[model samples]
Target: MALTLRHGVFMAPFHALEEDPTMCIHRDLELCEWLDRLGFDEAWIGEHHSAGFETIASPELFIAHAAAITQRLRFGTGVVSLPYHNPLMVANRLIQLDHQTRGRVMFGAGPGLLASDAMMLGIDPSTQRDRMLQALDVILRLFRGEVVTETTEWYTLVNARAHLLPYTRPHPEVSVASAVSPSGGRAAGRYDLSMLCVAAADGAAFDALAANWEIACRIAAEHGRSMDPARLRIVAPMHIAETREQARENVRFGFRKYIDYFNNNSPGRFPVPAGTDPVDWFVEKKLGVVGTPDDAIAMIERLQGQQGEFGVFLQQTHDWADWEGTKRSYELYARYVMPHFRGTNAARVASYQWVGENNVEFSGKRQAAVEAMFRKHEAEMARSGGGS
Candidate 1:
């Protein structure tokens, strides 16, 4: 199979113009328009409920509107929080969006972070894994046009069927965002789903991600199944510019905003080990690629070599809230980085062909917690008839 370099948009809620929320929406729309013109393969929106910073709480609604405006660019939820939704309803919405976009929809599902959001909805967050597995089974079955009736500890669906069928046969491509977790890799292998390894500029982190993929591939072989390296994806925060200095300056201020946001939300203050400052680790590790066009392309090539058959190069310019810089970065990456690998085929390895199963018992307790909370909210909504 030929290797395809998939370009995608990472749409974060930009509150640059804090006084006017609509302006942020418009800016995001404009960015989408630019991506379409630039020949990007997909645009991924994230799902975050009640997060004051990013307003795209409902990605399905946003992507539906995006479908109307763009002709070729695909729309996706970098992930829709599965534990928070009824799988049947989400499956219907996904299929509808796929049809609206004319078969250009990719599904990225996850059990969300943020305990406070779950708590507000009265969810225990403890049973999140069970919820994710059950929900995933339902959604996948629905996409496959199966009449599913499943009773799990957390959820029960009795002979539920979807009226809205996805345009893609057997459903559109599905991916899960793995944030440095072995469970993510195992899940991808277990379900035959794509594993999207989230990358920062850090080489060490990238290496660790590659190791996880190796484990996933090995596990798949044990189950008498095989995974193509091309099916693996890497999502990185990247910005490419004319010059390295310009790239640094362009991304610095915007990147700082994201750093502040994460730092503020991080729980517990652990003392740094004598030689390891997080900032230094980030730059040394290259967690977020901020460099000239040539440098960015080189970094991607390096990542591809390590990760194998990397499919998507999701450029996250919006995270910085610098529209002009974001546009420029996209253009630069398109002009320089994409051409080398866009249509190349993912390389195959003999070692990854088949292996014995380790019978890894992965647990998703956090995922369960989010699901329980969301189900409670769904129940309340059903009683009141007030939710979508």
Candidate 2:
């Protein structure tokens, strides 16, 4: 069987917090609606409680609202930051969402990133990963209808069971977030879940790409679970336009804002020199693909060639282009990019050519056969003395 790539977007929904709160959220919903109309596969909303620019605090709520506005587009929490909430509630809430969305939910769990958010919750950043693993373990058990009775430092559940099961055939697909880390891979392997590599475009993360999956597979072997490369997804930022120049010019507006947001909030992680061409900085950093639709296709194809089999290519969303430009990028992807990998458009073309080539010969033979039949009938009539 041939591998086909699925397209999705990973939206942090970044907007300056002071910006019109109403309009920001409305735009996020509109993004999902646009994706559904464009026949995209999925949209995963990010969760962040503290960061002023990274607005969406509850991705589940946003997913629920987006689910109503769109059809056939699956939604995920993007990473619910498992350490902050109780395991039972997380399990129950996700299961309920699966039912509500008719199984169109994919659970992507992670040890929350923002240290300030963890500090506010009184969670030690050092121990958060351990807590996340503990919570995820209990949640997985609860999902399987097994009663969980455990007392961890953060929370306790007494024989908790989820009577309300998921609508998906086993359960909605579960994924663990990895940022060039072995811990995320181990958790994914242990739970037999999908792996969502969040910073695939970052140079360091890209270097660790092959090693991370190897770690997951090794751990999975120890746990008697065979890892599937198709369950791995790599995410990157991209935008498409009519030409490279247009794409380069279009991303400058929000590209600068995006760089500024990071430098101001999480200093040193993404440092951009002042007054540099945003497009040059973008390309030099290997941050993402910004070119024509064909360029986007080549970017993904090259990644696949290097990384081997992976399931989905999730484009990171930023307000890089104006509204129409952003939507056109997605349209270009669905129109020119996706069909190439899926082999759908190529198949249609081949089928039409086959019909076109055979039709004339088929018609000519049928006409000759019909004429012969009439001639034979007329001859028989003349021989019987009934000829005109």
Candidate 3:
């Protein structure tokens, strides 16, 4: 059977610095409602502290509010920066969320993303990944009903156990973030967890897609576990419009701010040479799509070609466009791009073709039936001496 690719948003909640922070955050919540109404499968909210642009600090709190407003859209931590929290607290909160959402919660864990955030917390950037792994181990144990008693340089869990078991059987779908590193793959392989390839849009991470999956599969086999491609999610940035030119224009709203954030704060991650057009560079590098649904389809097809089969395509949500334009982009994606991959219209298309192919025969039968009815009516009229 072909994989049914799920679609969602990975909202770092990137907003322009000039926008009011409160309104920006509310708009993020509204965006969740908009996506849910558009039939998006999920929305993974990010956890970032120091980044002024990617401002949502608590994904859990955001998920709670967003989940209440939306009916069906599942929420994820987009990764709960595991190194930043104690395992016990993380597990408890996740369990509560799982129950609260009625199992519509997914737990995506990762090492903290912003180096500045880590610095403020007194966590060394080098140790974040290791700490994430350590935390994952304890969180898993707690979920499985184990009383964890362990000590690490960063955290100590002394007989730590969650009071409530996860509402999701076998626990809410656990996923780890994978960018360019093999660490996410290793952790997923060992724990038999899902993966969130957060930076699949980046050229370097794109190149590592197959290699990282290979590492996961190899390590899974060694651990006597099997990695499911259906559990793997690839995230990339995209903005769609009615036309390529229109999309390019739409992103002009705040694309510069996004570029500035990366170039100034996190340089080299998303490099745009001084003179080159940002959108052109972005598309040329195969970093993402900023065009029509056709372009989005091509980007996804490219990813499918690279990684074979994966479960989800998470659009990295950004303020590249205005509110209405952003909403329209998602609506267009739902109307066109999603169905292409999902085969949502395959049966409908087949039915349409079958009807069209038999149109002559069906039309002939309808004419014959109408003629027969007229003839019967004339015979009855003649018998009654009322025929003309």
Question: What C-alpha lDDT values do all the predictions have?
Answer: 0.72, 0.87, 0.93
**Candidate 2 lDDT tens digits, 1-388:** 6568888999987786457878889998998999999888988889998868778999999999999999999999898999989999999999999989999999999999889889999889999889889998988888888998889778878978998877886788999999877888989888898999988878788888888888899999999989888788889989899899999888875777877777776787676677777678777776788899888888787777767889899998888887888898999988988898778788789988997899899889999999999999989998999865
Q: How many clashes does each candidate structure show, in the order listed?
A: 24, 0, 0
Question: Which pairs clash in model 2?
Answer: none
What's the residue-level lDDT of 237 in candidate 1?
A: 73
Residue-wise lDDT of candidate 1 within 1-388, one digit each (tens)?
A: 7576777766755453243777777777887888898878888888776646666788888888877888889877877878888899889989988887778788988776656667776777876655776788789989988898877655678899998778898798888767665766777787888876654334445668777887788888888888876667677776777886777777665665565455555632222345664434444556666677777777777777776667777765445526777788888877766665654322333223322222232235556778999999989999888765
> Could you say which candidate leads in lDDT?
3
Q: How well does candidate 2 match the true structure in TM-score terms?
A: 0.89
Global CA lDDT of candidate 1, please? 0.72
Per-candidate TM-scores read 0.79, 0.89, 0.97
* Cand. 3 Cα-lDDT: 0.93
Can you rank all candidates by TM-score, best first?
Answer: 3, 2, 1
Q: How close is candidate 3 to the true structure, as a TM-score?
A: 0.97
Model 3 misplaced regions, further than 4 Å:
none
What is the Cα-based lDDT of residue 199 in candidate 2? Answer: 84
- The 10-residue segment with the lowest total lDDT in model 1: 354-363
